[model samples]
Target: MKAVASDSAIVLVVDDSPESLGMLNIALNNAGLMVLVALNGAQALSIIERITPDVVLLDGIMPEMDGFDTCRAIKQKLPNIPVIFMTGLTDSEYVIKGFEVGGVDYVTKPIVPDEVLARIRVHTQNAKLTQSAQAALDYAGQYVFCVSNDGALEWATPHVHELVDSLNGDAPCAWEQIQQLLAPWLAQGDQSQPLELTNFEPPLQAYFAGEHGSNHLLVRLVTPKKTKTAEALQQELPLTKREAQVLYWVSFGKTNWEVAQILDMSPRTVNKHLEQVFKKMGVDNRTAAAAISIRILESDEEAVG
Candidate 1:
């Protein structure tokens, strides 16, 4: 049987009505959840700054900062904590606004205990999965950032803002430059590309590893080993110089067309080189070749780290 986290979970309920707060508190506490209550938006923001909760149940209508404003403030401080809006507003526009302000799910007012519990369970589980993924990325020595289709910054690791600010004084400009740099790969749905950091003293070379989710482009940032020379890769593998280069880019999830752009070779030439690489490496496809290359690279990283 699958295990559900209950005892250690913390839920923050932000509402103005004493009745609503009392009902929610009683129900959530009975389920083995540690419940935190705030009478208004201001109080909720204060609580969030002090301690992080796993999930937040925010009331839509409140005095002096309403649900939308509070949720936005909460998102700015703790983006990973899921916010579920409990509102009497049945209008679709209000629901849309709730989502825009970073609400993960909505519960109509006069909340049903069972319904609210179910929604909380689902959103909390998702929040946990997201946290786990981010932790894995951190363990692997990478930072993550996500952007919307329009190139607006959605979320990023704390280190990312500092790095970006150092790169360019204006973060918007930096993001624009990155978007332009990745325009070609983005067109082809390529998930990873080498990023040139021009401002650093040593001129760090970072790779942008991206994956397209439902609405945003999720990216992982890693500083790869400086040696991408075909000669170096050829020395480690049985492949030729061009084959090694092709395999190196393939390991970063670049499509043949994108690889062609990077290597300044035609797509046909890249494919031809890949075929030879497969023959030498005894791999059936590009994915297998990439897997082998990644293993070798990760081994090198482990040895160095």
Candidate 2:
């Protein structure tokens, strides 16, 4: 049987029984989702390692490893991937165990094809949004510097501002000033660190900088680079800590009031921060702001790669 083609979602079906596997494959494929089947947990794990499916429909009973253990292992290995249990075991205790194993949902056997397809659609959509939000969060913590062909700073994340201030007594200068201030450091080759210069400054002064695309732009991150906390913070973009929080919600497509609820603030406060974000980003609306943020994030990933 052939399923419809939905380029956006990939579903992995794990069941030991050939009949059950075939049934799911037909159903999922008909619904326009790409489907992959594994007869057991071991095979499922191998498939997962090779291809990160949007969602996994796992059977509770399997040889070598049962669904719960498999689900736990998958979550540990790939925390972001969502798993849904598809099983004949409908006991409440079994359901609870599935949840404990990190299963996002449960569907009993003798499955209604429509219901299964609907649930898959819902979970896949949620997963896509969650991934996007996490990407945005990572983008917010990192340093992003776009340089012109002349080696001037076109733009820098706010964290770069902090780094510049620490490097020079009269810091927080415009992008042009930053280029001049860090000229020596920028001259360093790919493999070198600015240890000698940083040693003269505070010990906490550290940076991870890299060049991308024909050396047109240089991206730099400065912090106590060795610390775990600093690394985590560095993965985020250059937003005020609060703005980072707000941007997370924005990436999830939340309204101002919804964001306020999540942040435990009033809608007015959320709007105020949003306005500041707009002004700083030089974007007029939320859609434009989100697009710009995503672009900055994608660029950061390219620089890292």
Candidate 3:
């Protein structure tokens, strides 16, 4: 799901009054938003359980469960869902209470359709952008996470959690220990110097990528890939130093252009080195030569282990 919100821009409109629902449904639908209707808080929660809406337009006062209680419950289940309260309750306390219960915005009764639509558009667009960012991170196979200002884990990708497990070593940090480990680094704000967690073998480097939003501090985990030294590869294989370096990156599936950037050489020079690597290793193609490199690397790792 990439967290929350769908591409269709689904908006769940919850209100005890049929009048409000119909009016907003027409307005939202006319604006090209798919609207889901709910008669009360229970109905709203039920709808949310089945499908995540882009923004929840909830009535503030309803029978059984008021919008405040409903907002609290909704936040508990899906904190990413933005709830906006709409009711006749226009008092200062009501407005303040709405936000305290997780309402992102509040609109009083007799609300203009245009005003409500404007608010929904803003929240819905924000939610979609967030989903896109999370999906992009997953697509790139990145170990990244976002933490609250208090250093609590807000949201993270699966790979980031795996990195955290490795950083925990034998004792899993769970949550508290994780907060302690990350809190200090949050304050350090040093982007150039990577935060080192040396408790585990090979260790890990935490690079702060800066803030994602107002409260989320973005972090990326850097881990060393299994690679052999170019010198060691040259000595082990029937190839020169340049050929070894070329083959080393190529074995990891790097293109000739990419390998040239890493090795600080021209693309033509990289292709030339690759040709030498193939000839020396008695292989007709790069794939066959890569097989030889992988064998050498695996053997080296096995010996070290």
Best candidate, lDDT-wise? 3
Full-model lDDT for every candidate: 0.77, 0.69, 0.77
Better of 1 and 2 by lDDT: 1
Worst 10 residues of 1 by lDDT: 296-305
Clashes of 2: 12
lDDT of 3 by residue, 79-134 (tens): 87789889897789989999899888988889798998889888877875676476
lDDT of 2 at 17: 95
lDDT of 1 by residue, 1-305 (tens): 11233446789999999999999999999988889899998898888777678899999988889989999999998888899999999999999999999998998988999999999899988986686567546634435666655545666666666566666467778767766664554455544455555554334444545443334565555444554455556888998777888988899999999999999999999999998998999989999999988776555541111
- Candidate number that wins on TM-score, 2 or 3: 3
- TM for every model, in the order presented, reads 0.47, 0.47, 0.48
Model 3 residue 21 CA deviation (Å) reads 1.3
Off by over 4 Å in 1: 1-7, 141-304
Clashes of each: 0, 12, 0
The residue ranges of model 2 lying beyond 4 angstroms of the native Cα positions read 1-6, 142-305
Candidate 2 structure quality by residue, lDDT tens digits, 154-245: 55555655555665465644334545545555555442653223332433322435433233445554434232221222255455667656
